[model samples]
Target: MGALSDVRVVDLTQVLAGPYCTMLLADMGADVVKVERPGGDLIRSSPPHLDDPEAEPYGGYFQSVNRGKRSIELDLGADDDRETFLELVETADVVVENYRVGTMESFDLAYETLAERNPELIYASIRGFGDPRTGETDRQGQPSFDIIAQALGGVMEITGAEDGPPMKVGPGIGDLFTATLNCIGILGALHHRERTGEGQYVDTAMYDSMLSMTERAIYLQSYQGSPPTRCGNAHPTLFPYNAFAVADGYVVVSAFGTNHWRALCDGIDRPDLADAYPRPADRLEHREEIHAELTEWMATHTTDDVVDRLEGSVPVAPVQDTDAIFGDPHVHEREMLYEVDQPGAGETVDIAGSAIKMSKTNPKPRGRAPLLDEHREELLAELAAQHEAISEK
Candidate 1:
């Protein structure tokens, strides 16, 4: 049994955020039933490129997020299917969905509707803004994608360089972060349910979660002087505490403490240079000179040389690109990734492993993501039997 072996999640979510949350639960040994519509989730059709657009149901994006989930196709709008879904809520420990604000209500499947059947259900909703405050209709109208969440929530403003055009990260970082926040809230509510024999709603707007991540910028405006600016690769508090040039790539050095500054001086065999700048202002004033000197010195050294001379002794690291990150020693030891032999992708593709560790329960991947509606019959039978039983009494 894994950490969440007892939890059962009915995933009425599609695309990213809600699905990602259910994926986390499924990864930890929860029973996650992915209820898709008749046409299946739109992600199945999304592409970087597919071997066969019509034939291949497991696209890369869909496959990655939906792992360890059992899929069932149903038309939630159908009267029989709606009753079937209500049956699922009656038995579910949690129901996670990312439908627009009133989408569930429109289908007559809102938390209030589900809660009447199963008051013990942990109902989670992922919206664009929030349900109560942020305009409900605003979220319901047009689809608010991941970039929309980041772009509107001040993430884009502080992402790239101060002068450069605002940029979104390569991955759907906003959705993933918001999904994680949703998981945290759901877990809390679940624990409360276990204790008090009660359940509650967990709602988080992706925009709200994104805004929370920019706390320093937002909070600084109310109290201190200025809103935080994008410094590219620079740290907030110290000089020489950012990425620096090196022989093959780069190294990040944090000369934060006086002792660390002295250690750098001692390590580089430049004691006199250390005394030249003792305080923060001293380093800040001569930052260019210091950076230039450090860069020139680093240009002579390899990444190994950087680590060998001052890895633990000082806060410095050789900048690792993608390959270096995968081959890093710690990644191997911790099993942070796994080489999974995928169905179509022939060779083993490295996938991220579980971050959460449990001493007694080992959470291993049970199965790859299902083909569209792969377990439809199995789950439909489950719903039919459940609805039948509920109607009996």
Candidate 2:
């Protein structure tokens, strides 16, 4: 048994955000039945598919995020399939979707409708702006991609190089972050339901999540009466908190205050520069000069050298990329990465593992993403049985 062993999720989400959230649920031992359209998710044909259409529809993009979930293909737009979905929803413990705000209502699968039949169902939604509740729906519209969310929600304006135009982070920060927040809300709602014997709605909008992610800047703008600026690798307020160049690699160092700065200077055998950072206002004024001095000190040192010298003196780490992430020794010790064998895709690539590590019921991805709706026949058979029984009743 895993953490969510008893959970059954009807996943009607596609692309990334909602799917990623369902993937987490699937990994934690929830029975996630992913319902895709007949032609399949837009991702199946997105890129990196089997040479023949008959073989597999699992695009590498889909494979990466959809792992551990079962798939069932249904043309939801068609008349016959609506009953199948409604049946699934009636029995489902949770129903999740990220369709456009009205799409589910258009399909008659909205929480208001489903909860009439499934009072205990935890109806969760992920959207671009927000549900009709938190505002921003009518004025701004229901559709927003990750970049759009980041742009409107306050990330794009403050991200990227100081000299460069505002840029999206390399990762799909808005999408993934929204998924994470949605997952949290789902868990919270589940907990509330479990305790009160009542199910409630959970909603997460990319806009709201992105705004929360940028709340500091929001605070700065509203209360401090100043807007945020692009700080490159450095933090908005923390001192000496940027990545620095090293001999063979780069390391990040953060000395938050005078005491840590003093310790860092002494550790480097250069007490002369201790608190040379001066007060916060002064250091903020002389940031370039201070950065230059620290860069000069670390210019000849390797990443490991700086780590060794500054181990306890300050917060420091090497600037590690993806490949480096897999190779890191700590990654091995913590078992933070997982590997699986693909039949012919060669060796299984190291992928990030479940952050939820339970002692009693630890769960993992059961299999690679299904080759399109490989389990369609099996899933439809079950739904078919339910359908016949409902008709007989």
Candidate 3:
């Protein structure tokens, strides 16, 4: 059993951010019941599926993030379904969702309504802007995805090559980061409830999350009176903290401190470079010359050779692809890849494992993502049992 084994979560989230947060809760041993609409989540049909879509239920996009949760379909628009949902909430420790503002209100299932049903319920929401219960904004009703948040929240402003256009990050940081923050808020609310026997609302916005992530740029702009722009693979302030092209592949080197810089110089057999650029400022001042010299040397050596020479002396790593990551012994040792049965895929496939590690009650995914409404009968039985137990009381 995990640390949160006793907690039950009513997950009314669809698509990426909301489902991802509930997935984390499930990993920590929460009994997460995913309350889907009649047709199910929008991303269930996202491509790259096996030959049999019906047996598989969903593609990799849905499977990757929605693991370890029970699914039940309910049409919130219907009165009977709404009553059933409220009953589920009455027994839940948490209620999480990621919908546009006023969505729950339309179904008459707002946070206020749910809190009335279960006073100790932690109501958490991940929105593009935020719910009005916390704060209202002009963009409250606007639907947004990862790219919109990245562009509006300053992540795109400082990404990409210096001369190139602003770019979205390779991964969906907007959704993922927002979801993680919302999870933290939910955990905090749970703690508060444990202390005071009172639950509260937790709100996280994707735009806000992206802005918080790009805090470095904000501080730099405040101090220098100008916003920093993209610098390709280089750090704006730190010299030799960038990716360099080796003969076979690219390797990143971080020689920020004086000792590491000296070690890098010695490892590369260029002690004179260390003598000339002894201080951090000196290295920053002559970064172009230093980069050119390092690049010239790296052009002759393979990524492995560079790593071998600087492994213990300086912070260095090859720019790894998925192939390298899959084959890495360290990754396997850390249990960062979790394998699960992929319905129609003929064999088990791997999803990312949980990063949270504890000495006792370690968190991990309980099982694969559920087929749509797979747990409907099971969940209904559970609700019936609860009703009987309450009647006896």
Candidate 4:
């Protein structure tokens, strides 16, 4: 049994953010029942399928975030299916969804309605601008995706090269960050319910999450009275904290303090430069010159050579691509890369494993993502049993 083995979640979410949040809960042993529309999640048809082209549904995108959960088809628009969903919610500890504003109320499945059925149900929503119940926003009705969140939330403005245009981050931090925050909110509500026998509404906005992630820019703008721009790989305050090109690849190095700067200089056999810029402020002032010197030094050496000389002395790591990450011993040791069998693909594939480690109940992916409505009969039987038990009482 896992930490959340006793908890049951009715997941009325699709795509990245909502699925990811419930996936985390599912990893912790929550009985997550994913309710899909009749047509199913659009991501099921997303590209980059595994080896089998003929596989029924073979998208890594959908499989990665929807793992360890049971799925059932439920057309909420239909009266019978809506009633069935309400019954499921009545027995659930949590109900999570990522629909746009006012979508749930149209079907009469809003948190208020669900809460009436099960007073202790923790209802959570992940949206682009958050629910108005928490706080009103001008953009409450506007639909937003990851890039929109990144751009409006100030991360893109301070992410690229100093001379280049604003850039979107490679990964979808906008969605994933909100998902993580939603998970935290749900956990907090669960704790409160445990103590007081009361449930609450939990919500997180993608834009709000991105703003929180880029808090450095907010503080910088407030303190300096000016917006910060992109500085490429270099930091705004710390010198020698940037990526340097090596013989074959790139490596990031950080010499934040005087001691680390001295150690780095010594490692590179540039004690003269270190002597010239002894203080952190001095180094910051001559950042360009120092970067040039370090760049030249690194250009002549391989990534392995630089790491060998400064691995323990100064913080340094070679920039890794997916192939390098796949073969990394540290990743394997930490169980960060998990291999699971994909029944739809008729083969095994590697998915990212959970990073949140618990001492007593270490969470991991329970199984592969289910095929569409794979657990329909099983869940119906379980629900029937639950109803019978409640009736007997």
Instruction: Sort by TM-score, best first.
Output: 4, 3, 2, 1
Model 2: residues with Cα > 4 Å off, grouped in runs:
47-57, 133-136, 275-282, 341-347, 381-393
- Candidates 1 and 4 compared: the better one by TM-score is 4
TM-score versus the correct structure, for each prediction? 0.89, 0.90, 0.98, 0.98
Displacement of residue 312 (Cα, Å) in model 3 is 1.6
- RMSD (Cα, Å) for all candidates, in order, is 2.9, 2.9, 1.1, 1.0
The residue-by-residue lDDT of candidate 1 on 1-393, one tens digit each, is: 878889889998989888888888888899999999888888976654345434454566776778888887878889987877776777789999888777888998878888889889998888777675234534444567789988878778777765787777667867988999999999999889889989888888888888898776787677777766666666555787877777788888888678888888787777886899998788888877987888788889887887788877899888777798898989878777765444555544556667777778866555677777778688878877876888999
Model 3: which ten-residue window has the lowest total lDDT?
Answer: 48-57
Better of 2 and 3 by lDDT: 3
lDDT of 2 by residue, 34-147 (tens): 888877777765667545544444556787778877888877777778877777888788888888777887777678889998899998888887777446446334578999
Expressed as tens digits, the lDDT of each residue in 1-393 for candidate 3 is 988999999999988999999998899999999999998999998966767644586878888888999999999999988998999999899999988888899998999999999999899999999888888888899999999999999999899999999999999999999999999999999999999999999999999999999999999999999989999989999988999999999999999799999999999999999999999999999999999999999999999899999998899999999999999999999889998888866778788999999889899878788889999999999999999999999
Model 2 Cα displacement at 224 (Å)? 2.1
Model 4 local distance difference test score: 0.92
Report lDDT (Cα) of residue 96, candidate 4.
93
TM value for model 2: 0.90
Model 2, position 5: C-alpha lDDT score = 82
lDDT of each: 0.79, 0.81, 0.92, 0.92
Q: Which ranges in model 4 have alpha carbons more than 4 Å from their true place?
A: none
